[model samples]
Target: MMIGSSNKRLMSDINVTPFVDVMLVLLIIFMVTAPMMVQGVNVSLPETTAQPLPSEKEHLIVTIDQKGQVHISNYPVAMESLRHKLSKILEGRSDREVYLRADKKIPYGNVVKVMAEIKAAGVEKLGMVTVPIDETPADR
Candidate 1:
């Protein structure tokens, strides 16, 4: 008795359907999560459609507490040294921006002082952060 062999082609093609499906899923996920992604200090931003701020990039955070305490990146810095520190931070980053976050109760003078220091550091565009007023009790 002899056995007969039949010719059957082996599938040699790669299936790209799974790859496409995965990419589509990733795209949807990113789209859904894009709005939820917040990229900076979580301050109750002050209102005023003063135009939106530039998206997070390397930035210098200068905080002036209500008591007139000055902080640079959360580190307590002397008023005299603020300029030097800012200069160092902006050393390689000539394009870097400085964002000032001060307490609402902070005196205008204090805020101005911080801005002055930032300007002295040679940074032209200094952005300030504030909390927007809320009418809703829940927000309050």
Candidate 2:
């Protein structure tokens, strides 16, 4: 108990037990909650005058960007392969429907090209997703 004795030296090692415990707790929490997270493909949908589409149990989503980049379920696909991919996907489920999410800035020709590919796949029912244009603040 001397005032400045070597035995009274302060502890130099960081106490990591508390930190390790917290990390373990967080790991367990994430493990338990991870599967509960709903995953979705991101795309900027164009606006439409049609009524809102109803939700479905399972549906395929295809996105076309302004630069004419095509993505199926977030996986990028080339124009040459789009037809084959669409055909393969539509072959598995004969009655399955597809939702097309094309950006507003995309050229009409590009959108039409994607539609043509889907039509060739024999997907009878196709839906275009759009975001409603919000009115101006003054109008609101």
lDDT of 1 at 140: 29
Tens-digit lDDT string for candidate 1 (2-120): 57967689989999999999999999999999976643333333454455455857667887766667777767789889999989988888686788887776667877877988999
lDDT of 2: 0.78
Can you give the TM-score per candidate against the true fold? 0.57, 0.63
Looking at model 2, residue 19 earns an lDDT score of: 100
Please state the error at residue 55 of candidate 1 in Å.
Answer: 0.8
lDDT on C-alpha atoms for all candidate structures: 0.75, 0.78
Using TM-score as the measure, the top candidate is: 2
Residue runs of model 1 more than 4 Å from their true location after superposition: 1-54, 135-140
